[model samples]
Target: MSKAFTKEEDGTEKIRLDDLPQSTHPNLVTPSGLADLKARLAAARLELENLRARPEEIDSTMAIAVAERDIRFLESRISKAILIDPKDHSSGVVEFGATIDVVNEEDEQLTFRIVGEDEANPAQGLIAPYSPLGVALLGGETGGTVEWQKPSGVVELEIIAIRFE
Candidate 1:
């Protein structure tokens, strides 16, 4: 219902880059990102195992291509994965991968995880920082509240917690 506004000594309102942390945690693996790579590896391994089980299929070029493609993708991803230092370490501010909990006036507690654009899945409560709600909640403090516009109307949220390490 409210927002964390800062005022200068001159009584002028101050703008913020974000309310949450922007730094990547020590572990930058988005669940989806990690899962995608893992699934590919597993699929490729399974295909290799299958080839051993069914010797007749071992010589099938098409079958080999199916498994090889998965392996290639995994190799490409893990090789280029950039593990960056956590962007915002201030415990006072929210950042990426922070599991924020907010209580609406209705007393319903909502949970969200700020993630990368490619990793966002609202159905799973993972939000991309570029999203309106995510942008509003970035660099926020645990006890701070925020407001942002939604398709329906103005929506409010409280920052219950944030994690950076």
Candidate 2:
């Protein structure tokens, strides 16, 4: 067996960490999103250091491997990030970092912030720029209707407002 796979004196096998898959879409990030990524990277590094300092603890090896994997992923994201401030973008356009309010065909109103893929949280009303709805909303003027194909069928949304903050 290779030394890498060998068991340690405490009978814990050396864990191998795998790199996370990178997103193919462009890495556009808001200023706050970039800050979040940097903070996560710092926390991951600190966790990894703590895990390594207690190598003989048996469970620490797996924890260390996980932390290392997170660090690698965060580092990649930070390096590839392209910061874009919503305040700097032109008003009334659905560019990245724009918060938009829309009304659906059913007269239900919804709000979403167009953000980078990494920062997207659908439940939080944050949508990725490459999403079907996001793409349709881009360049759409207020009071204009945009249609997108959804799993249920085609859905239409009328842009009620656009704001960059």
Top-lDDT structure, candidate number: 2
Model 1 Cα shift for residue 5 (angstroms): 60
Identify the leading candidate in terms of TM-score: 2
Name the runs in model 2 displaced over 4 angstroms.
Answer: 1-14
Candidate 1 TM-score to native: 0.54
Estimated TM-score for each candidate: 0.54, 0.89
Cα distance off (Å), candidate 2, residue 97: 0.7
Model 1 score (lDDT): 0.65
lDDT of each: 0.65, 0.87
- Quickly count the clashes in candidate 1: 15
For 8-105, candidate 2 gives per-residue lDDT tens digits of 78886876676788999889999989999999999999988888888788688777767877888999999999999999987776888999999998
- Return the clash pairs for model 2, or none: none
* Candidate 1 lDDT for residue 81: 53
